[model samples]
Target: MIFEMTTQVRVSNIEEGHKWYETLINKHPDFIPHKGFVEWELIPGCWLQVAEGELTEGNGPLRLGVTDIEGERERLIKELTIERFEIHSRPEVPVKWGTFRDPWGNRIGFFEYLDKKEEETQIKSILGTDSSRV
Candidate 1:
């Protein structure tokens, strides 16, 4: 019966973390409730929060769905100066994925579906739009 969800990652400095995440996500946060916290509604009700606090480890390689994993990886490497991370996949796997740590050491990653049709279907379902029309 869960209607919405959120995942939080902590950073030592809110200002730097906010800018880093903004660059990675390519958008300003959808909400900033207080001085030390910010949130982005990544997809409808699902939220990703960045907070000012002590760092935590082994939290998540929070993999976001993307249309192009290679392109994203390259962009991140160039923009964030993150070490190149390898994308992995198997014959039975439906998507390719790669993980890299943020400047604060939070695990984050991207995934791209192997099937373009399935990718479009998910996009249409989430956005409630006809891909052919857009």
Candidate 2:
């Protein structure tokens, strides 16, 4: 059985990659084990690694969940200068989502649950906090 998982994205310049990711995630990396690589434990054992090396494409659109997809999208555009992308949703779908790429060509995106009750449950369980405050 799989107990843990990690995803690594490559970048040609580690320092620039670190700065861009920091702005996107709103924190310094959780760990920098050595030069040219860093890791963030996005949730418990799940890790997102930024490593310096040859870049690759079609690797992502690694979507993350948020309480406010539209707001996060705006913030990312304003702060990181990412192109404004359309948010997509369907009545049958529980969440709305939008995808964009990072500076290193790693695709990433955000999604927000359309139902507040469901979103609250998600926030509370994932963050271990009152969803009302989220």
Candidate 3:
């Protein structure tokens, strides 16, 4: 069975890319196995790697689930100086999402479930705790 996954993005400079991703994710990488490569375990089985290499152009708008999309947008703008991006949703859709680009032009985005209960359940599942109690 396909049980785990990893996604990679490339940048010309490892130091700058590492710092940028660390700030965006609000934590240092969980793994740095060698020079010029770093990774974060975004969830239990999913990993995101940033490596030193040619830019991976037009790769993705890798969306992360968030509790507050607008708040995250504001934080990214203030902290990373990213250009403001619009959040969108539809009546038929269960979540709202927004996209922006990192300094190296990697597409990144965040999403928030409209149903707060569902979002909480997901959070608990990923973290193995009731976030509200923590």
Pairs clashing in candidate 3? none
**TM-scores for the candidates:** 0.96, 0.92, 0.96
Model 3 CA RMSD to the hidden true structure, in angstroms: 1.0
In the range 1-134, model 2's lDDT, one tens digit per residue, is 99788999999999999999888888889999999999988866788999999999899888888877888988988999999988999989988999999888899989988888888887788778886775
Residues forming the 10-long window of minimal summed lDDT in candidate 3: 125-134
Point out the worst 10-residue segment of candidate 1 by lDDT: 125-134
Runs of candidate 3 with Cα error greater than 4 angstroms are: none
2 or 3, greater by TM-score: 3
Clashes of each: 0, 1, 0
Pick by lDDT: 1 or 2, better one: 1
TM-score attained by model 1 = 0.96
The deviation in Å at residue 98 for candidate 2 is 0.4
